[model samples]
Target: MKALDRAELQRRFPEGVPVQCGKSSSSHLVSPNEIFAVESKMFFLVGPVGVILSFLSGGVFVYSNWSNVLGDDLAFLFLVPIIILIPWLIAYTFIKNERARISLFNRHYI
Candidate 1:
């Protein structure tokens, strides 16, 4: 996205934009509510770590079943993907929000 100039920013958000991370200055003030909101919003920032862990769990599951009778079960094969998919979504949300926050901070707050 194209970045707007200071004048445009001032015109767009006359009250000033609330920054979640970084130091506050005379021009940038942090409000308690804004801070709370930002912190809450930042809760999902696990990124690739979550994804890696999810994959690792899948790997362990596959390895455990490789030499066992469970591997032959059709239900187990179908359920493993579905089971890991729940955690994958959590990981995905975390990664996406983290990237978005980083981009927003770099583009506007720096």
Candidate 2:
């Protein structure tokens, strides 16, 4: 981790070095909720890339299995793309919101 500036240390600590926020001074200052929120946002942003790759690979799989499993029912094939797309859309929305929130928080902090 980078060393803290004097002002940040003062704002967060206000007492002395090794000041506690909750548990340990060094380890427990950041909120887990905020960390989770940021991580969830990152997950959302990256999920679509994985989904796209998976969808393409699944198309190949479906093609390989079509004769034995699906027979001639090509209509069911549409469901695969829809399922991939829906989740990606939801994740994109979540990522957008989270990024906005992070930007706003940074602006306020800085």
Candidate 3:
């Protein structure tokens, strides 16, 4: 996307523009979206990454702690499921919120 001039931004988004920008990276908001569009995009982009990372981290922890786990009772059955579930809850929340945000943004912005 091309950079927008001040005049263009004002013209395009008179109310306000939502921008998502990465920190500590060479990133900039190329354009602004309605709050809803930005939020939906956030869900589409960041939700999966969060889910995958959580699963990977949980797997690594489970693998590294297998010896300790088995030495105990069926603690793993409880612990492992919890570990998997927490991330799912978080991702599900993001997705639901994203959908809501998008819907609300569309209702007002569009």
Candidate 4:
């Protein structure tokens, strides 16, 4: 996308405009939806990477502490399902929020 001047921004997004966007990569934004577009890097970190790490961490925890789990008569074992589902929950939430954010965008990023 091209950089928008104040007049173009006002004409394009007549509802409103944001004064500035991005702390490290500062620029004017035509709309708040731009924030989501600019900050989309978080999706990878909290989505796929986070899900993978959570599964790996959960596996390690279950493996290293298997005996304790059995010793507790499967009480500690209950955590396994929660650990497994947490990634799906996180991913679903991010996807849902992304869909909502996309609906607000004046133009599509991808």
Which structure is stronger by TM-score: 2 or 4?
4
Worst ten-residue run, lDDT, model 4?
1-10
Show how many residue pairs clash in every candidate, following the order shown.
Answer: 0, 0, 0, 0
> Candidate 3, which segments miss by more than 4 Å at Cα?
1-39, 69-72, 104-110
**Cα lDDT for residue 104, candidate 3:** 57
Q: Who wins the TM-score comparison?
A: 3
Give candidate 4 regions above 4 Å deviation: 1-41, 69-72, 104-110
Q: In terms of TM-score, how similar is model 1 to the real structure?
A: 0.42
Best by lDDT: 4
TM-score of 3: 0.51
Better of 2 and 4 by lDDT: 4
lDDT (CA) per prediction: 0.55, 0.55, 0.62, 0.64
Model 1, 27-85: lDDT tens per residue? Answer: 55433223211223444455455667777888888777876434467777775687668
TM-score of each: 0.42, 0.40, 0.51, 0.50
Which residue window of length 10 is worst by lDDT in model 3? 27-36
Cα lDDT tens digits for candidate 3, 1-110: 22223444546766555454667455333433423244436667776787788788789878988887768657766877788778789889867866675565455422
Give the runs in model 2 whose Cα sits over 4 Å from its true position.
1-12, 15-49, 64-77
Residue 64 lDDT, candidate 2, scale 0-100? 71
Candidate rank order under lDDT: 4, 3, 1, 2
